[model samples]
Every structure is written in C-alpha cells, then in structure tokens.
Target: MALRACGLIIFRRHLIPKMDNTAVEFLLLQASDGIHHWTPPKGHVEPGESDLDTALRETQEEAGIEAGQLTIIEGFRRELNYVAWEKPKTVIYWLAEVKDYDVEVRLSPEHQAYRWLGLDEACQLAQFKDLKAVLQEGHQFLCSTAP
Candidate 1:
C-alpha cells in the first residue's frame, strides 16, 4: 500500500500591501532530516483518521496553527503521488487561509526552519514540480475568488 499523508497549504493575505506586490504569502517548513527538503506541514495518516482531520492535526502539530485559526477554502484540495525511499507515497493537501496574518508559528522539532514567501519565491523554493503546481493552482484559485 502507498504511504498516505495529508496537510494544509496555509497562506495569509497582508492587510497592507507590501512593496505594492500581491498581498498573499505562503508558509513553508524545512525538514530537519533526510535531504532537509522544504514543504507545507504534513504527516502520515493515523489509523481511522479522515484526510481532512489528518491535515488539520498535522498543521497544528507541525506549524502550531490551530484549526480555529484557519479558514479552509472549499474546492481547492490537491493530491500528489510519488516514490520515496523505494515506496509509493501519496499526499493530500487542502488550501487554508490564516485568519490572522500575525499568528505566531512555533515549529516542531521535525522542521529546522520556516519561511513565508510570495508565489514566485515559494515556487522556486518548492523545488518539486508537483508542489509548485499545487501552489500555483492554489494562488490562482484565491485570486479568482478574492473580493
């Protein structure tokens, strides 16, 4: 069976535009182990947990962002499948917006660092094609739906 995981693609919109750029920024965390790759907060699904539940739980554990602090965007879930460590891996992600842009991020020991980046920088940092595509799609979705 493929290893299944779920996570949130958490982002925030700046109330005041910074440098006249798009007010959106995405949150990314750099892992402490393996290749030290950067990704959104995610973890393996525990027994009997729904994908959304696992995404919320992992977001809280990995990024210290509680469920109540985020607004999960409808119609923007994504899934990616790939090989890792000679095994198949599948990851599910949902788009979520931080209710407060200033909410503190307390990283767990799994991550060595965290960054909030704009779309271009985020896509560059993401490194993986699938992840970059997800970010792009999420960004477009938010832009289209914004007031």
Candidate 2:
C-alpha cells in the first residue's frame, strides 16, 4: 500500500495598488531533518482523517497557519506519486490563499525556517522536479483564476 500524505500550497497576495501574478507569494518550510529541502507543510495521514483534514492539520502544526486564515481554492488539486524510504508514497496538494496579506508564519521544530517566495524563487528552493512542478501548476492556477 502506498503511504498517503496531504498538504496545501499556501500563498498570500501582497496588498498592492495593482494586482498581478508578481504580487503573489508561496509559503515554503525548510525541513529540519533529511536533506533540509524546502516544501509546503505536509504530513502522513492519521487513522480516520480525511485528506483535506490532514492537510489542514499539518499546515497548522508545521506552519502555524490556522484554517480560519486561509481560503482554500476550489477545483485545484495535484497528486504526485513517488518512492520514499523504499516504499511507494502518494502526496496530494491543494491550493490555499491567505486572507490577510500581513499574516505571520510561526514554524514548528520539524521545520527550521519558512519563506514566502515568488513563483521562480519558490520553484528554485523546492528542489525536486515534482514539487517544483506542483508549485508552478499552483501559480498558473492562481494566475488564471485571478480577477
């Protein structure tokens, strides 16, 4: 059986006079262990928990962003399958935008640091191709959905 996990591609829009894709930024947390790679907050699913619930819980536990502070984007979900620790793992991600542009991010011990970065910088820091692709896809989704 594949190990399943879920997370949110959390982003915030700058309060700019002119709104554009450039004014959007993604939140990525740097893991304290492993290779210290950066990625969105996520964790393994616990028994009886829905995927979205796990994502919300992990986001709060890892990044300290409460569910009330985010607006989960509809119709935008990405799933990636890979091998980790000799086992098949599947990760599901949904896009979420911070309601308050100035909301703070408090990281837990599992992550050493966090950054809100633009699409290009975020993809660079994400490292893995699949994760970078997810970030890019989320960016494009947000851009296309922007009014």
In order, candidate lDDTs are 0.94, 0.93
* Residue-by-residue lDDT tens digits, candidate 1, 1-147: 999999999999976656754578999999999888889999999999999999999999999999999999999999999998899999999999999989999999999999999999999989799999999999999999988
lDDT of 2 at 61: 96
lDDT of 2: 0.93
* Over 4 Å off, model 2: 15-22
The prediction achieving the highest lDDT against the true structure is 1
TM-score of each: 0.94, 0.95
Error of 1 at 46 (Å): 0.4
